[model samples]
Target: MGVKITGIGSYIPSEIAKNEHFGKHHFYNEDGTRFGHENDVIIEKFKAITGISERRYLPKTLVTSDIASFAAENALKNASLNKEELDYIIVAHNYGDVNYDSVQSDTVPSIATRVKHNLKIEKPTCVAYDVLFGCPGWIEGMIQANAFIKSGIAKKCLVIGAESLSRVVDPHDRDSMIYSDGAGAAIVEKSSEEGGILSHYSATFAFEEAHFIYFGESNNLELKDTRRYIKMYGRKIYEFALSNVPDAMKTCLDQSGISVDEVKMIFIHQANEKMDEAIVNRFYKLYDRTPPKDSMPMSIDKLGNSSVATIPTLYDLVLNNELKGYSVKENDVVIFASVGAGMNINAIVYRI
Candidate 1:
């Protein structure tokens, strides 16, 4: 009784937004004060900190569910599984389908339902729903699929993490440069193979950190509109992750009975380069060693942070040999971890 990802796929947006794209834009502090430094200085500092040179943006004609379906279709094809055989379709996203013309997010029928409809999966028994646990949504979906398979309630499930962060970001906010648009999905099913998902851990720290990331008015006070966009206290979130994420990953790995040395890779959320590096370093420190070189494969340099989509997308690229200089072999152990809004943190110890 093992739950394993049989196939994986991702849809990286075709629209490339280089850092220079934001050079002409005005950036203001959270209190509406103008920056003393020029845009070039700000951009360089942002790149140095986030390791993001460029990011992808969804085109005007597409929405969140649209890219989700594309990734779902690719996963189904990669798995060679029939649509009708799927027992579940779970979509992990923060903002739903957002049109370029509207400031509102539409999730009337649920993104999973829309994805199923787009895929033409007519199986009424194929339960479809959405999860909004911040950036950890994708890994959480995978954990749910594992439970379903282990409980004998499902044989095959499609777990997708997709986001159009570009659609929800405030252009006036410098943090907007940390977001991108993309989709990634995996086909999880019961397998006779040896190793699969071994252990997982999740926690929410909402007591004092509930609003660490939220929807808020633009940093530019000149815009007198009542609209809100994705916003966060970058410093607070960074500190929160540094203090908690590493411990969560260690707990998950300890439960999996896999020693630190056995971990071949760690697919952490692409929130920030420095934050992720610190988290991983701390996780390795728990075992009294440093992270092995190439132990973490990152796509944030080009993709930015797609929230829930980051880990699955990075894993899909590596598994397909599409990510340069990174590859995974059979029997290799890996860890998937994430921290995001909801002040949530989660990790999954997996074996390939």
Candidate 2:
């Protein structure tokens, strides 16, 4: 039996944070100097380059698990399956439920565990756990679910990517503006029909250039001992992803023994519009062709960089025919690819 995504769902917070929501104090220049009101140029450049006009943030009452549970329920409902039917629940997140403080104060009852509880599942056979593979966590979960179904270890799995990013962002940090809160999920089950997940490849190059996105103090150039927030090297990450991600996708397609022209859609991580556009262009250029318009659908314009949630959420939109001029149909081939924080890169080929 092949593993196939039977259903998909996503949840974005109601609170919309716009680019102008942040002021001068929230940014700093390359030299660690303050980026005062004169930083409007930076905001303009970010929106122009990343295509992100706004993003979501959870209300004080909502946590990562709440968003996860909502999306999970929608996925299960879309599949016309009950919670009891789930053989596995795999949640992918970089940090657990972050409160308003943005600090991970708890981990025992994992985000997956919390989601399980929130779902109110009573079946003990429905095991649940979490994966921490940077932005590729959900893809890794899907790969693992494919293995499980192929090996007869599971009949159905609920794979989810959820995060409360606002909790981890430093208000004074411009990079934080690109982060958002949301969740996405899919129901992967065994299928007797052909055209499911076809090929997979993953690699880590941390030793080459590590700690691109890390947690550290909130102060200027100095790395303080205490405050905890997400910090990123934007230019370095952009360069790294450009150099490696496309090759990884091409390698995956090559291994699948399929022509790049056969790809109907590509659900890439909604990290940055310009970077993603560059990656897709280069991927097609390898075969001396150009990417078809609308071949790659994006959600970053509405949701910013939601890390692991990007692919699943985008897939959900496509599956539901919510993306204009972009939809998935049978016999179509789709490629999923991502590169993020760990300097980790992975890609999967799926046939519908």
Q: Which 10-residue span in candidate 2 carries the lowest summed lDDT?
A: 23-32
lDDT of each: 0.95, 0.88
Q: Which stretches of candidate 2 lie over 4 Å from their true place?
A: 30-32, 220-225
Question: Worst 10-residue stretch by lDDT in candidate 1?
Answer: 1-10
lDDT of 1 by residue, 156-179 (tens): 999999999988888889999999
lDDT score, candidate 1, position 124: 97
Tens digit of per-residue lDDT, candidate 2, span 1-352 = 5689998899978999888887444476546677765667878887999999999888998888899999999999999998898999999998787777544545679989999999999999899999988898899999999998899889999999998888887766778879998899999999999878899999888885779988866746664546588888999999999888989999999998889889998999999999999999998988898998789999999888888999998898888888888887888999999988787889999998
Positional deviation of residue 42's Cα in model 1 after best superposition, in angstroms: 0.3
User: Using alpha carbons, what is the TM-score of model 2?
Assistant: 0.95
